[model samples]
Target: MIEWFTIVQVSVAVAAGLLCVVLGLAGRKPSDLTMGAAALVEVLLIAQLVIAIASPAFGNEPTGSLLEFYIYLVSAVLLPVAGGFWALIERSRWSTVVLGAVCLAVAVMVYRMNVIWFVQGA
Candidate 1:
């Protein structure tokens, strides 16, 4: 994993998460803005997935367990998807908060994945 790209992913996730959380706390229901933020996080995760799959070909291999890295990557990709679906079905402010929480969780998970890839066993 490229360090710069990982930083970008984490930054976006944090910004999106904070935005959604603030909106929800302001009594706003799930709206396009909130949904779009969640979607953006999801998109980044998808890009990370693609990068992870392709990076090894370019001689960028993880220093830690490959299985563990894939597990973290795949799960990080799922959080926004599940949160967005729940928000769509529930249509509540709390669901927006949940989406925000999911983004935050994804950020932490991505950081851990970064550590697993580049820090551990280095």
Candidate 2:
């Protein structure tokens, strides 16, 4: 995975999480801006996946674990895409909650990506 893209994804997820918390506190639904950010995050994740497929490296280790990589990649892409659509359809505080959940999940996915790249299973 691309380290820079991973960093960007993590930053975006944190920002989205903060936005969700603020929106939830204010009793406001998710705005288009929020959804847009989520979309941006998805785009970055796709880029990361492409980079990984092209150059799979984790701290000098060969990232040939296709199954693990694909699992994380698919989920990382799917969660935000689904959440963005679901938020648009729901358009309530629940939407923000969904976004928040997506953000949280993305964060976890990034961590998993790192582990997959940098650490060997015992």
What are the Cα lDDT values of the candidates? 0.93, 0.77
Task: Write the residue-wise lDDT of candidate 1 on 40-71 in tens digits.
Answer: 99998899999999999999999998899999
**Candidate that would win on lDDT:** 1
Local error of candidate 1 at residue 88 (angstroms): 0.4
- Number of clashes in model 2? 0
Runs with alpha carbons beyond 4 Å of true place in candidate 1: none
Pairs of residues clashing in candidate 1: none
Q: Count of backbone clashes for each model?
A: 0, 0
Candidate 2 runs further than 4 Å off? 57-64
Give one digit per residue, the lDDT tens place, for model 2 in 3-119: 666777788887886787677567888887778778877887888777777773434443446578678888888999899888888889878877877887887888778777766
TM match of model 2 to true structure: 0.85
